[model samples]
Target: MDASRQIAARIEFLRRQLVDREPGPLRDAYLAVPTRERPVLQGTTTPALTQIWQQRPSGLITPATAETQPIDLIDVYLTFEEIFGFAAGPAYPVKQLQALPLGFVLQFCAELLNALSRPGASHSDVDRAFATQWLKEPIRTRVLNELRDPRRALVVPQALMLLARAAVEHSPDSLPDGAKPGNLIGALLAFSDMIGPSGEGGPTVLGEQPGDLGREVIANQYFNNNASVPHTFARYVRRWRELPQQFAGKDGLVDLPAVYEQCTGVTLDDLTVVAGALWAAACNGNVLTPTAELETLLPAGQVAKVLALISADLETLRQAVQSERARRHTEWTFDAFQQRPVIRLGAFLLVMDQRHLIDRAFGWLPILDVRFPPDTHPRPTNHEKLAGQAIRTLRRFSELYVSEVLHSITGQGTTTRRVYDDPELKAAFQGEGQKIADAAVDYGDTWVVVEVTTSQLQRDAATAVPGNAQVKDIDKLLEEVRQIDATIQALRRDESRLTGVSSQIRRRYLPLLLLTEGFPVNPVSMTVIRERAHKRGLLQGQDVMPLEVIDVEELEWIEALQEQQGVSLLAVVQRKQASSLERTSMRSFLADTITTPLSHPQRFEGKVSKALGPLEAVLLKRKQREP
Candidate 1:
């Protein structure tokens, strides 16, 4: 097939694999179309994909105000239960239920759905239908009721956002002429409330507020700073200016101080007369202004117009103080303590600033969200000389601890606990310091003292913590430490002797045994025999075996002898003994016959004696006898 047809067939196979259905004619269509343009022809969903896509509505529709309609609230509640499998509290009172309108029921539905979606879905999904449905419900009343009923109000911000969006979506009339509107304040307020007093604002809903005049103002002034106290204050100040009617009295006159005090808890007189100066300084960017304001706001305060001014800027002031507090906490300067040539017992010198130390140890670090900060650098308050002495003592103590407990169990420097912070102790252990230092816990109490110096502890009884480490216990580490040391010493002493013996055994004896072929051998007996043979000049002095010294002619001769007899070298020695025995037997026979001839007893005796004497001599005088 051509390349294009092959490609078409491959595409059909992939479609079948993914969707579990054959492409068939569709494969031909796909091949006919241009590759890049094929993407446009694909449907939004296929049979395999539609099952997961359209199961739920596009957006999470939270609680909203329902339009006027006579409907069974119970039936709507049941519908939600059927759809989402969520449960609700005891049904609303039937009497109260009768007075409730369609709007109230829609609001209830939105809230119920939002609660159900929280665990699995995002808040955006929950906020989608808020514009049309949930927002129409009374935002404040619903929020207040949520606050009172903890169970129902458990999801404050999400519920509020839903209502806010619903109100914005339904109230086209609330927006200015020919201008698009959004639920900027409602979203912000909902976020702020959701955070509650603890400041957990939950997930951000939109990228940013849409472009609406009122929304832009709210976004920059209030929501921008998030956790910044000053930014929160600025936001409240702007909010006060925009919503004058909310703070106005029956006479239609705005009560500025009341609004400021309510939002920031600062009085007007205090703002103008006392904090007025600090406010001016802060506006000009003076660092000390916040501190100055704290002093003013706490003391005798002013009221009326002055209070109103302070109230207007309350959030700003709060933010400034918080910023100043944060700055002071982190502004630390290090002082190098001069080294004293000598240190006396009980000498007092500040080690570190209590404030910084406390903070470094346990202060709130917003980044980590937990305490237990690391003790970074240990700055010495004493002179270098004095500090050195203290470090020496600490190291000595740690080493002693390791030696006492770990040495007995595993041996002195061999253990893991013997290292220490002291220079002397570390030097003493040297390469083994890590091992010993690790065992410090086993030695004794391994507490670190930041306050006491080594010199002080030596001179004053009170300076030393009672029951310091001892030498005897340190000696116990010797048990474990000695194992490695002993092994090393033994090896050094015997290596030469063992190596020489092994070389002699392998070179001289091994080949001799191999050549003999059937020589009966025992390693222990062979070793003994070889040593004796060496002393007796049987083996050569050079330590090479004698047999090995033979040339190829001798080796071939020995090999041929064995081949002809079908016997090993051991049998050749036995055969030489048999030849000697036969010669002795012949001589003995001749002597005996000559002495006892047939009937001549007297003369035969004489002849026999002479013959026997000569024969015996000849028999005894054979060339050699078997060994």
Candidate 2:
């Protein structure tokens, strides 16, 4: 009989005896069943218990009904097979599949199958596969799923981190792939943003504990392994870089918590994961500042584990960064060259112009051109454009600057030395006449003058010259000179109007001065104070003293009348208050007009006296009016 049939047959024979029940018969019948069915026959599955209800010949269930029903042996074995295919070790024969409790057996078998599949696979490939799947069905879907267990949803990001960490530890490609997978990163960030503000339940990212398996895996590979960590570290460092001074806290960094709270939704979670990733990454030989405040909450032993992991990964990250840096420099150099290619056919004209201009202006020796064959030229396609394209191709490198190339050519700060030193560029212009003559050639008794102008000269030495100076005719050049002169004169006049720095000391704040009185300080003192404030960037750098002052006689009269009525008139009126007072007065006037308060003689007199300031007091005295 098949295994399921045999087990079932044994169960049936035991059920018959349970109904008949004789001690000697029961013992013998239990022994008759197979070893696998023995436990069922005895009804002693761990924490031993017996069936309370059973089927019987009568309508009601007795012990016999429960016993005769017979467990679905086929379904039980099929469920076990469906859950876990493997039985034991990697090399264990599949033919030796044995029976065991379903849940326990499945756990062991699934783990074994996974291990068997992992052998020669790379981390990057695994990361890519996971990322593809994640992008299509991200954790956000699960987080939003109404039917999902909240605890399971909460741990999804950690699970992703776990897989990423495994790849990072075992495979170099995995770290790079995981770091650059924008879709996966975006989903993770979105989920984190949603959770950050909720602040309910456990932390989403794993901490450094054995129980925190996800974090441990990330730590082991990112920090402890030989792969570089900056790929991970950049996840955080970019945020804090170039932080504004005023926004920074007492620690010289922005208050992360407050900033995070202001950012609603999934953003807060993104910040946490990014910060954690960066911390781990930087520990692996990256150059970002190790902010200690972030690490203070972690346990002591985990810190040591992290440090060890970083030590292991440092070299890999270092090499990767170095390779990237060198690649960047190369592309930058190529672009600078392309943007300003060396002079080929037209170099002589530029040389001539430089010599002529300098000799005429300052009587200096001519600057020599670096010699090369006429054909020795930069690529017909711009060298700089090619370099720029190449440099831009690099994913994370910062662009190259002119200063970097200048440093490579003549050490740091050489452009200043080359352009401004001693003879000055003006002195080189006079020798242009010599350059024009040398570049000319005679053909068989026919004389021809090759036109050598500053434009041609500029093209020749574009790479070397700081400014693009090509000699145009007197009119255009004269116009340029006039524009420059005008600009300089304007600047000088503006400078003369500005107050000296010493004025800052003279206009210093005077303590105990009556603030409401608008203290009668000197005009110069007020002007200087205003100017100083403008220079120091206070009041948005507005020169209060320079602004025109105007008087509002109507407002002054109204204010004076208020003061005469015994109201404090020191109020510095504001727009909001003025609007409110206007609204109230209009409402009061309308209400009084509508009610006809003047109909009562005493009330009318009283209202008139209050509004006209004691006018009614004079009018009411009949004797005083009898003149």
Candidate 3:
């Protein structure tokens, strides 16, 4: 459901209108009327009433009133856009989409694209209009299913504008001087593409398909701007470029279509879906651009300045984090790693996840004082053996921690037991190839299958396979949870006695995978994992619980552990929904304790400048000394 690639494509489209590094027009130049222009219409431009009257059914407009009719084509299209709710610019709210039929948007976009490609006869040179049509339900369902949400759905209008504008901006020569795309690039092109490629369907006016549009667009985008789209796209393109024999011919031109198919798995029925998926992931919201907050705002524009500010903002944040880390000293003991009351692994996971650096933090796990026994902390030697024991002690503590927390929450009726107690299941897991659940809990009419995991083994975040080549570590971990959930479901269906539930009891299975990031990634990124699994027809049901990566207040947990002798699981889960992170308390805790020089924009700018000033001065001095 991530819209990274689509976002990338949109950004590339916008880059034509925005992201200019040169000294040029602040406003979009395409909106301005060209000094020298030729008329697209064959004859003198007539009033709107005359145009619609000509197309009117036999008796709708009589000679008595035809010439005097006040209706306008602009009014008609505007009403259509409003009623149907396909605005030519920006995203519409999910609430606004309720009135639209399912397939209408896609059908509209197709028509608009077609109309733009092969323009029709209009009375004005600036005529950019569409033939009217209704959206169907089936196409809407199909597009929605492929897209997964309204965010990408709303991008359809923006997509049309991006494409139409990019076509004009980048391939100006290709657009016919007479049939120029009008000032209403946002609205008219949106309607044009909605209609169809050439408005050639049964209800359409059917013109010759603009075959050259495809070639011109693809070539212009791919070759221009040092490769249009995200820089990440270049890496995908490089995959085929590196292995020329597999995809390229002796003539040396790479088979782009094959490469795209090979890289992203674009098939027909799911072409929209696959492309949407890749785009969502590629142009993921996590990947920030300078004008990300107000991407549409212009005139009093600051978009071009954003790229530099982003670098400054990031550097500022990095320095601030490093400073906070220096001052962040906990009185809690790591020596207690051997003891059950140890540092909260849950708290550790939550903090690192806030900065999107869990995997990197996990990779640095060996640096922890707990890795060695308390006895070995001061003068550590032969650490491997001690570290092994530490890991076992910590793991046992984590298991016990979960058991205790659940015991408090569920009271007497329900029980959460580590599945390791089951001899048969434990033996099955030990059997060379089999898998088993980490824990199982009985909680008020539900059998919760638990799988605990960390990206501790994830060395390279860039690789598809985190721990093993055959499976992503997270997927492998979740598979075991799913299997256990399924097994419980089957057993309940067949009347088997699970620990807390009797043979007569009916309990639905809820599979919970407590996943912690080992590498830095967006907190919402776990959806990419679940979605990818669902796309492959695995993990596709309401029975599968959402991957729980809830963020808890690290400081509150620390306070409770330090003073109240416990960290509350109920409190942690209650603080946020699964995959939702609230960094307010965490940030407040840090700010109250630390200087936080880069927290606000003005201060952040001042700090960044100050940090850079010294470095720049030193570098200049070094250069002078060298000369």
* Comparing 2 and 3 on lDDT, the stronger one: 3
Task: Give the 10-residue window scoring lowest on summed lDDT in candidate 2.
Answer: 508-517
* Top lDDT hit: 3
Ranking by lDDT: 3, 1, 2
Q: How well does model 3 score by local distance difference test?
A: 0.31
The positional error of residue 119 in candidate 3, measured at the CA in angstroms, is: 62
The TM-score of candidate 1 is 0.15
The better-scoring model by lDDT among 1 and 3 is: 3
Model 2 misplaced regions, further than 4 Å: 1-155, 172-627
How well does candidate 2 match the true structure, expressed as C-alpha RMSD? Answer: 39.9
Q: Which scores greater on TM-score, model 2 or model 3?
A: 3
lDDT of 3 by residue, 1-627 (tens): 469988998887755543243345533444332122222222112112322214322223433333212121111122225334554433322222323321232223333432322213121111211211223455444433433321122223224433322222222222334553333323433533343222112212212211222222212221111111221122222222222335344333344334323332221112222122222222332221223222222211322222111112222323433443333221111111111111111111001011111111111232243343233114335455544544453343333334433343333221332232233344433445435565555544555555554433232212121122213544564464465555454445442333433545545555545432222112223443455455556434564544343211222222233233333332333333321232212222323333323212111224323322323443455567673
